[model samples]
Target: FGTDTANQVEEALKSFKQANVQTLVLDLRDNGGGYLTAATDILDLFFSSDEVIYQMKEKNSAAKKYYASTDSKYEFVNGYILVNGNTASASELTAGALQSEKGYQLVGTTTYGKGSAQTQKTLSDGSVLKYTYAKWMIPNGTCINGKGLTPDIEVENVSLDGISTKDVKETLKVDCVNTRIKSMQKMLNILGYSADREDGYFSVATQDALKKFEADNDLTVDGEYSQNDKQMMIARMMIYINNHENDKQYEYLMKIIK
Candidate 1:
């Protein structure tokens, strides 16, 4: 959320209204969250002035309830929020509020589970300190600090889900045993190649899968995973996800909407 995000959402809602779009799917995947006021502003679009958006509990102070102050511009008969493990803070707040108050269903995976509010202060020594001072909760008064909001409909995107590739340092070949090999094996298996195992060991089957991928992509027929091969695999995986050829979560959402 930013200063302009609410404005953009308002404009989008206006367009949707003009187009007679009655249902809404708010995609909040990988949103790490931002300003609280921005979130409240966006929530104001879907809630009335008397509705409580969220509650804040600061140290040694009574919990304060924040209410929406504006009328909703558009009312959807059905609404869903698409979230993932990376959705945090204000994103969780918005999702939780809508889910609790408006009966909106949350689709996709669990959220990132960050419910604290933080502030920063500059000291006299020219240093800055940032720290969490308060906790926020949904309208039900349940704080989702460590436990993320569970999805009403759980859906996993298996084709694009895998271990991180940041620690892949060296070239991987048959007989290599490391996390990189495991990550590569998982990717290859998800991409429809038979890597046989994903236990961090690069077997002959893994080598063969690599070779097949290389041959299919017009690369050298080497049964090894180099940095270039990793890059190519990531690019291809991105294209696959971007094309949405097999988005199970989205498919389920469409089915439910129909």
Candidate 2:
């Protein structure tokens, strides 16, 4: 969220209205969150001016509710928010408000619980110190601190093993046991090659899968993982994700929407 995020969303809604689009899917996955005003501004686009968007509680103070300040610009018969583990703070705030206020269902994994708000102060030496001063809650008054909001429709994307080519520092071959091998194994599985196992062990089946990947991509058909192989595998992984061939979350969303 930023100063321009609400403006950008408003512009996009205008396009959607012109195209006669009634259903909406707001994807907030991996959004670490930003300006609280931006979140409220975007929420105003969908909520009535009198509705409560969220609530905040300061130390030793009563909870204060924030109401929508603007009339809705668009109203859809159905809407869904996509969230994941990285959806935190203001993003979580937006998702939780939409879920609680509008009855909009959330689709995907649990959010990154971040209910606390912080303020910064500059010291005499000009250094800045940030500290939590308040906690924010959803419209229904649930403070999602360490316990994140669970989705109404839970779905997960295909695993990427959370490793990349940069993480592979050494060549990997048969009988070697490492996280890099597990990453390569997962990638191979997603790319339609069977690596047999994904336990960080470079078994014979894993070597065969690597060789097949190399042969298919016109690289040298060696049963070993090298720097070039790592690069090529990463490229193929990107292509797979870009093509949305393994987007299980999206697939489930479409199934329910249809």
Candidate 3:
């Protein structure tokens, strides 16, 4: 979902060496684990004497923890990582290593709680199970198998206004979100929303169309559309569409698209 690993890590360290950095936050919300060897090499940058960072055990096989010979080069003034229930596998491994082992503080919510390790193997049935065959444990010997590590600090936008979709004038990332406006227009046309175009460009007519869509869905009458506002509105339409077309072969696929 981002730049290549080598580039991202190098850029991070370069940014780190820039100034007196306090409270660095590494976000791994939608990150999926890649090459184990790559993960091992990256972990070496954060540890002393290239010791074992993590042990990946799978199936009835012998388990092994990776070790690096190189010493740690950069230490954080304040290291913080963000993980959500979406975080999985090697992401959890890195977080657990830095936290329970290397002592990097964790923020945000708990992890996905998927502790069992899986290696790719073709099954006898010619299908892939990606089965979990072994458990991964942190250096502190805490096995986060099935139960994720809870965040030290839980930040909730507890304001009722936070949940309220009404009165939002605009989104923060407006330029990057105009493509969504096009999608809204397409969906609006499918549902009889009036608009002159579906070109994926934001225009006054598109904003008005969104306002009408919001009003139809009982969303706040705000003229400017936020990502959530659009998403919630789409989700409602999709649910209605699904309910009516539940018998369609593509109905489940529609849900997946959503």
Candidate 4:
């Protein structure tokens, strides 16, 4: 990661330490991934020193393993991780590492299962060379490329008439009453949006929260939550939970609701 992302994570961890959070749930659903170094650095925040976090092997090259160098400063007694089919690459790496190494509970569906490592190089002809040069494995020694790691507890997503909640554009707006609304509100609350209640009622507060999420994500500002907006909201919530699971308000909502 760059300075900006690292600085933001440090700020969040500082706030979490100040809050004295004990339990945390890191959500990795729909996270495609970024820099591998960034993922490993974040994993370092949870693991003890001398634990192997990742192993990499390139073509005809010896495998190299990376270990945690320091004990986790902000340790938690109970830690959970959430994942889904859209979680891939470095996201999958982090999830697998925590599950296999630290015994973190994984909840939700199977991950996207991308395990190869790629690198980009500028050639002498000014063209770029980008290709898969290696593959990575978690502490368990299993490479999650095509075969994804299953969750310890699989929680099905709420749906209506065989349609997922994120696809139901009409019934997901303000004042809607459905079982899936609770999931929507829970996600909103997890993302630091003011979804007042999780009683399956898309109330005014929920609508306002949806509006704020849309506005912040560069979507059309409206109370009506479209399918795209709902998906984006879920993605953003996953990112937020992955980064700020120890935030006081997020932990409070997680204990009170889902």
Candidate 5:
């Protein structure tokens, strides 16, 4: 804001550089509700202008690009975001900027999926009413409104005995997961879902495997895959490909199952 939010951020970053603070944690919880333009501007520091920081969608169609400024150069490294369940509005935007744009380590949980961007429209009654106008999507062309961005890793808020039993730590390497999803031929080869060899990337063999999984689970096996189905597919594959390396393959697998 004109009141000095941007400068404060700059100053903070400068201070971090001067202080040489390692393992920085940006706590953006319980503080949100902001102007859309401002959020996008701040996003510039962590992403290039060519990057589509986020998008605006009116209907359920593909999002329209709300691109970053091309003249801007933002690259943040070694970032850790501490987001909680109660965070909303502009706060969510900040967290999303870090997560979607920078791919920072998210250590709390999933975020609120309020996709529609809102504005305070002044009515004839001389009163301002909040009206939702457009939904928001990340630069990668993924919607983040009704469906919040899932964490690359899942961790809990509470822990004891220097260990956590109350929560599940499911670490998701973006590339590895996607590799596993896309390359279904390999999974099929090993699982005996088909006689197809693992060529990496989803082909007819992968789709067929997905259908079989859905049929077995009594879930609707639509050739068109998705997030829930993707998770299910990966879980089944995990049983077979336990802690398998080859990140590209993993990413392919994640995408197909998703």
Candidate 6:
């Protein structure tokens, strides 16, 4: 949290510099946050010395300003900070600092706004007392306490549209043979409805599975995977994969559909 963490970050930056990486993307979609100093220290890497990165103001204590140090080691041409609803506290600090100070672009959805600073105090008992000590602000004096910072490029949590199977006919019944039938089977299995296999043949097992899926999802249970059923499955699979966005299997399913 103190020295070792800073050392690791420095080492990673060294590697990036050695590789001559110009564009850096820091993906902090699910990063919750940690030591406040660590956030500011990393923020220091992008800007020159004496630049105001962030501000800390408490009720009782005087306002404190955090400035960038002489640690502009990597002169990256551009920086992108990826964030979402799970990005909070230190993650927000880092994003806000870079955006406000260096004009770095933020991608993805809005962040989880938690701009309060906390301090740890040791009591007589051996236990520590942690309390909110200050509130942080961006360099422009913008407070991101309850309202999260919006991304410059707002990409919805779902994948882009038109990522489904192509050239679907109006009807697909049992024993129907189509090349995309295998893709349908793959998506069905991914959504937990067993298509049994992906042999590009619409067998009876696939039909039964489709019927059960349609019934469960409140679609027309006609035992036929028609155009309406394909549309319904597309919507259903989008929602399912959105919910399971972090799972690699669902991610692969998304890629295959595209």
Residue 51 of model 4 has an lDDT of 80
lDDT of each: 0.88, 0.88, 0.63, 0.75, 0.57, 0.77
lDDT tens per residue, model 1, 55-101 = 99999998899889987646888999988899899999999999999
Candidate 1, which segments miss by more than 4 Å at Cα? 159-170
Candidate numbers, best TM-score first, in rank order = 1, 2, 6, 4, 3, 5
RMSD of 4: 10.3
Clashing pairs in 2: none
- Residue-by-residue lDDT tens digits, candidate 2, 1-258: 999999999999999989999789998988999999999999989888888999999999999999999876588789999888989999999999989878889999999899999889999999999999999999889999998889999998765546666656777888999878888888888889999988889999999988999999998897888888888888988888877547778878888889
Q: Per-residue lDDT of 93-211 in model 5, one digit per residue for the tens?
A: 76777776676765555766666776688899999998777777666667666666565555443211121112213322222233434343344444557724343344555666767
Question: Model 1 clash tally?
Answer: 0
Model 2, TM vs. native? 0.93
Candidate 2 vs candidate 6: which has greater lDDT? 2
lDDT, candidate 5, equals 0.57
RMSD value for candidate 2: 1.7
Between 1 and 3, whose TM-score is larger?
Answer: 1
Which ten-residue region of model 2 has the weakest summed lDDT?
159-168
lDDT of 3 by residue, 76-136 (tens): 7666666667777678777887887666766656787766765678889899767556787
- Candidate 4 at residue 217, lDDT? 89
> By the lDDT metric, which is better: model 1 or model 3?
1
RMSD per candidate (Å) reads 1.7, 1.7, 14.8, 10.3, 16.1, 12.0
- Residue lDDT tens for model 6, 29-135: 77888888888787767666768878889898766877788756456777777778888988898898888777788877899999898888899999999998789
TM-score (all chains, Cα) for each model: 0.94, 0.93, 0.55, 0.60, 0.53, 0.61
